[model samples]
Target chain A: MKTLIAIKEQYHTWVHEAFPAMHPLLLPLCNKPFIEYLIDFAILAGSREVRLLSDGQLTEVEEHCGTGSRWGIELSYANLHPADDQQQLLDKNRKFCGGGRTMILTGYNFISYNKQKSYLDLATIATDTPIASCPGGTITLKGPPESGASEKSPLAPFSITPLDSVQSYFRISMETLQTGSSRYVLPGYGSEPDCSIGKNVIISKTAQIRKPVSIGDNVQILPKTIIGPSAIIGSNVVIDNGCSVSGSIIIDNTYIGENLEIDMRIAAGNTLIDPTSGVSLTMEDPHLLVGIKTWATTAILKRKTIHALAATILLVLQFIPFILLFPLLKLQGKWKDDPYMQETGLAGALAVAISLDRFPLLLKVITGKLDIIGSSSRSTCAGKHSYPDSGPLSRLAVFSYAEAEDWPVNGSDAAIVERFHAVHSTPIKDIGMTIKALINRLTKGR
Target chain B: MAFRLDTLNGITVGIAELNGRLVAENSTILQKTCSDWQQKTPFLVFDCSNLDFIDSSGLGTIVGCLRKALEKNGDIKLAGLNAKVAMVFELTKAKKLFSIFSNAGEAAASFAASPVSSKTQ
Candidate 1:
């Protein structure tokens, strides 16, 4: 069976007002994208192919779900007109429909379904009408029912709630959290009931976490802080010392201040919201409550000064070597002037033997255009070497921090390591990293 | 920025109706007005039904007003806080510091029923 998930722009109008930064389809319910739940349901209903139709741009959704090969289902996307009805939609997507039994999920609604329950019976139901519906949208079955299916037993009932308001969004999230993994396929891992935590979570010894809580990856719970009873802390969040958080959802990239109490609220960045009342307040003072700034610029001037001095010293040491080796390498067809492939010469035996290739990048460090030890340099031109979503901490450097730590020199893991050190490392620490990176480069014969 | 002073049941209660937003630019006005209102009566009620928004500065100003009321053996209570304004109070934990009522009249009436040496005093 094929699934056609059509979500109209009007269905998610409230999401744009509540969370301007988040795409309605990408909204996280329990640290998982809302669309993933629909996809899971589609798979359970025996869908081999899924097509997402939306009036709004589906670029982010396409990037996130990709071809849906991860779920062993072929995923496709199409644009829909706001005025298009059910018949027009079917006519437009006739090629995708292929005249087979199709399940059309039309709305931005939360479908309540237990993962343990097999929805394969949807294929056997002989109905061309809407199987379920709410104010926001409806779920309807199209095409003829399969033959040799049991007609005696009735189909199992399914429920869906319209995600029309902030209160409903909050209520659904809390409901899912309360339900835990028993009814839904939620993210995170837990051995006990009602406690799921993700990777790289740092919990202080004095911090207390009660049951019925869900915490995402890279979360830091400082000393004397209490989390739980009913709490959801998203990824890259930091709950400071002497704070108590109960019955609240702290979104990603947020910093909860010290000695504070967060109860029955939803905090996203600087905005604190009361779910019950649908009230929101944007905090002005960063110390009291603020978004966690990703980059570390506290001692940038000091780091630049140290890097310049180190670069100058290295320039003096390598000046004569570079002058002698460059001409020889150029004559031997071993030297290239490509900016993106600066490290290509380093791969050569002659360049590695005398460390002549690193001399040019030291000039960049001296000019303050690059860090002595940070993230690897990428080209400004469009290509695979260009940095995607160049975050604040992703600075071009002569020597990468990943190399200093002997981690993978490329990919997401390397970027994470670089960002971690960039935010935590001092000028003095950077010097040690530079030395380590230099040693690693020389010892590795590249 | 101004208060509507009224005496209900032998207790002089100052009612301040805040409208629109109480942000950093005009938060000082509320602080000044509440300080002056403290001199006239010990019991104060901030009617916030019309208030739509509040930032951290506005929250601090309210906390300061409560402190001023406390110094004069007086008390400041909150009333008719809309969902948005009430959320700011809850987030900062300022809701715990004062007695909250459903309306200005209720808040004023409660001041008269309570003894002078009650929790606020």
Candidate 2:
């Protein structure tokens, strides 16, 4: 059987306001991302393939999910139109659905299901009608029901709850913690029940830990700190000395200061939230609370530095050749003063070979305005060009990825190749790719 | 920031109305003014209705003011904090340090009601 999971941006818009830094699908519930729960459910239902459909950007989801080989299932992603109906969805994914029984899971809802329970019976449900549904979402089986075993059968036990607000999210997380690994496969390690801990944890010997707690990776419980009878601590968290955290969630990259007593609150970085009222507060004091910024910004800085260095080298290398050939080419009428330049003769070929045309843009790289290698724009027609300026794949750069890979791409195919590398390439890899781009340009010039 | 003294039920309370963003650039302004305000009357009510944003420095100044007021047997109560400002207080666990009221009038009057108890021990 196959499963098609559809989620619209409209349903998960609350995520933007509450947790602006987090993607809704990646929203953690009891230290497990929300999407994994859905995927697990699909796997439990004996699905060999699952296709994730969303109207929103799914790059982060794709990065997390990959090809689903880890789960031993074929996973794919596709865009969804906001106005697409169920029939349209089936029509768009006709090849994926095929003639086999397909399960359709839609909406931004939490599926309450047990991993131990046999959900293979889910295939016996009637086609095109919701077997189980709530105000949040529905689970429907498509195609003929299990090769004509029976026209209908009762659904395997499950329920869906709407994750519409912070309160619901808190409740669901707490609920999941209380339920533990019995109902779902939560990510953690615990020798005993109702207590899950992740890697690189430093719990102070003097610190106290109560049952029914989920602690994620790289967490530190300082001296005399007391961690919950019901607490969900995310990764890279620090509970300072004499602090007591119970019935609360300390999200990733957060620090709780000394002697602070957090009861039934959600502390995410500098933001503290009252779950019952959905009121969030941004803490103005760093000593008491703050966000632990790890390597992401540092990584960006490092990449920028590398790109700038590479661009600077290119700028210096082309300095003399550009001075020698550029004005000569202009004198010969082969080089234009404007952005659009054509090199047809020896001057043109030498200028192109030395990458003299990219001198102006290399400055942008040095100024940290553009990448050294990224998606390159081209004139598709008269004063018309196509290049991604936004989204995850968009990049402004001196050298194009298509040129780097030396792909014989034309029109839209060039866009496809550049887009692929924009997301996948790293700074060091981009340097190699940039060299390839330069080599390809020199060869093409000859 | 603007400051004025008001006699609330026989207690002289200074009400400091913080305006706009209290970020790093102007946090020192508040810190300097807090010392001057304490000379007149250490008991203060920080009216934060007009405060749109605050950073760690701004919050640190407030905490410093509270500490100074406490040393002189005075108290700093907060009032009229909007949602955004209130969030900052809660995130830093600073809300636990001060007695908050909906308005300056209520916060200042509380000083008169039990001035001795208002002092953080």
Candidate 3:
């Protein structure tokens, strides 16, 4: 017996737009993809060969499935026209479907079935009639009529639901993650119900799994994090720690950061989103963390324009201060030379008096290597020593928010205070904060 | 910032009611305005029954006000934080910094019952 699965461009478009690098068929529902469910359904139905047909670009699907060698089944991919009907589809693939018994699974619908049940045997020997489907596609059977077979219960418990929106998508995934692989033949193993993991996953011990969750394969859950009761983390993802993920679906290849809260949202690639509302927010700030944007297109000129504008302003602002304070600080031996010192955690931080040390750093900000009001730049050494939750915004600034507020200059509390300002502070606000910092320094006479 | 100084059971407790968004736009105004209120009565309660949002700056200002009150040997408590603003405090771990009450009246009354500090001592 052979199986025919067909998906069209109209349905595939959502997959491509939602997941750029991954194939829609391979996109996991729960921790499994919609297509894998079809494959599992085909394998159960006593089919040795499954042919996938789509009107969209099937290259991604082909690369992913690849003859289905892993499942020990002959899987082949083909394309159909946009206007092809069911009869036309059958005629076009007559050779593949020539076997007297054929089970046709079509459309972008999500088929919900139990792996433990023998639904395939039931479909083969009991139902002789073709199963007509709705708008999302339906399951139909053809070939020859079955011999005197007892009437069987309708496939009510195992229903195929269509995923039309992001809300449904999030719900389905969260449900699957919580259910785990034992209930659904999931790809990975975690022995715990809180973790429904997929195939080929890499989990670090330092990373904390709170359970009642589902995780996909080829995933890296980084250190010092909490993942939850209703979390669906997709495959090929990196969840960096000091982060808390609860009631969320983190789509593939998404990079979450330390001390970040991803609650009630679906983070697909670089897009931080509210999936239920379909509100996609592209975070311009990368230091906090970011997902990878699938499209490589960018306007280089826009960046250059902003940098040039910033440079002109900085050069003008720093002229008098740079010349006057440089020699004075150097003469006092207060201007210490530390190369890439910011990354060494908060300790590698150099304490500069007032507005004196900001002269050089301002140039870095204009060059775009530094954000004028962005995260304080951390030194490489400091980054290594700092704990996952240890103030993620530890990169020291010549003028810190804590300094402006007369708080302790170089402690964890100071780092937290500064980081909060760094994340919320904008360029316009930076100008105001910088002035306040200068005034504070002048009044303190430090 | 609407502040009311009341004496309950011979204890002076100042209740400062905050309305709308306590954000950077007017967080400083709260600080400057609340300074006089802090001086009038050391024990205080910030009634956040109508507060909808609070950014980091607003949070800082509140912390600053708390510090000022503490310096005068008294304390400031929070009351009636809505879910959204409460979420911000929880995320930043600032929820631990205050003695939160269910309502402003409760917070104000708690101060009178406790008499935060002995004025004569």
Candidate 4:
């Protein structure tokens, strides 16, 4: 049987409000996207072809489910209008429906079905009306029923609940967690009851875990911390020292700070949310709650190496010019030397014209102390320094990216430009930026 | 927020009715009102049936009122908590700190039944 799943954006508006960064259908329930459960159900009900129709953008869902080859089914997506009715939907997908028995699943509701139960018989069940429904959506069957369908026994009742609010979302998550893998095909692995753990998990010896918990990959549970009895910790999470997390869902890439207590809540990055109350707190102190860095080390290393090589070449080209101009400029008082500070303003302009001021900074780049083109150096003072939005990756460079792009040399706007390049610029792109910086310096004489 | 005082079985219970949204801007009013209510009668019942939404500041204010009542050797019970308001209490583990009931009368009656009230009288 072919399956048609129609999900409207307005149906899950509450989810969008709560987790603005996540697509409503892609919201993770027990470490699995909500849409996957619907797909799993469709496949189990003897669906070979599944088409998803959404009034909202389906690019993320399409990219994720793609062809559904992993589940050995054909998956497709189509656009739907907000005002589209059942007949209009049927008319639009007439080619895919193709006179075959089609199951229509609509709304953003949670379908309660046991994996152990055989729902393949749903294909043979003759029904013109909706089989089951909640306020959020409905399940309807179209086309002719299979011939020689057994009339022996009754099928198990189908149930679905509208996930209209955070309370319902939280309740459903807890329900799925409590049921474990026996009832649903959940992500992660656990041979034992109520304990599903993913790969590369690091639990400190001093930390305690009470079961009925699900933990995802690359999680770090620090010393003196206690997790679970009823907790779901998503992948790439760091639960810091002396913390206790119980009856909470710590979403992926979140860092829970030291000596904190998180109970019956949901935490994503610096946002600590009380799901029941719809109350949320954005922690200002990064030490209390923050987002864990997830950039690949190999990529950073490659960029740094390319920057260093470029700095080395620039240093060699400027060596003779520095030797010839330094003594003349200093004797004429056009240059002033300070061990801790580099030349700036008129002296800085003369040094750049001769390419002398950047000489010492280029040498520092080869030592891995700086980059060839990046953000300006922030003070090393303990509490007064500021960093770019790209975090540690936005290192100080011999020639600032602001100078290359001809933006203001310093301040918040320059930091933004540096951060944008730090996150997105490639090694080859850095070489281009280096050329731009040299041209800008020669033209501006600074 | 509006408050009404009533005597149930000789125990004065202050009922604070919270309506609409209890968020940062208006949460202070509830806190101040609760403080004044505590002085008149230590037993308090927060009726939140009409409340639709609440943020962290509002939750904190309610917790603060509970603390004030406890300091006076009195207690705060919550009643008529809608699903949304009840969810906030449950998530913060604040539900464990109070005697919750379906309505104000039930909550007020419980205060009268408790042995601490008889002893204080």
Top candidate by lDDT: 2
Checking candidate 2 for backbone clashes, the offending pairs are A281-B87, A282-B87, A282-B88
Give the DockQ-based CAPRI class for model 4. Answer: incorrect
Model 3, residue A67: what's the lDDT? 90
Local accuracy of candidate 1 as per-residue lDDT tens digits, B1-121: 4578888777788898888988889998887777777878877888888888888788889889888788888888888988767776776678889888899899888888883725642
How much of the true A–B contact set does each candidate keep?
A: 0.80, 0.35, 0.05, 0.00
Clashing residue pairs in candidate 1 (N, C-alpha, C atoms within 3 angstroms):
none
| Top candidate (DockQ) | 1
| Residue-by-residue lDDT tens digits, candidate 2, B1-121 | 7889999777799999998999888999999999999999989999998998887688889999999998998989999988767766765578888998999889888998897745342
Candidate 4 lDDT score at position A368:
82
List per-prediction Cα lDDT, in the order shown: 0.81, 0.83, 0.67, 0.80
Which is better, 1 or 2, measured by lDDT? 2
Candidate with better TM-score, 1 vs 3: 1
Model 2 has a clash total of 3
Model 3 scores a TM of: 0.53
Candidate 3's residue-wise lDDT over A226-330, tens digit each?
887578887777887677888888887677755777778777765665666665554433543366444323433353345346545756866876676557556
Candidate 1 Cα deviation (angstroms), residue B49: 5.1
Q: Give the per-residue Cα lDDT of candidate 3 at A225.
A: 77
lDDT of 1: 0.81
TM-score of chain A of each: 0.66, 0.71, 0.61, 0.68
What DockQ does each candidate score versus the true complex, computed on alpha carbons? Answer: 0.44, 0.32, 0.09, 0.05
Error of 4 at A282 (Å): 1.2
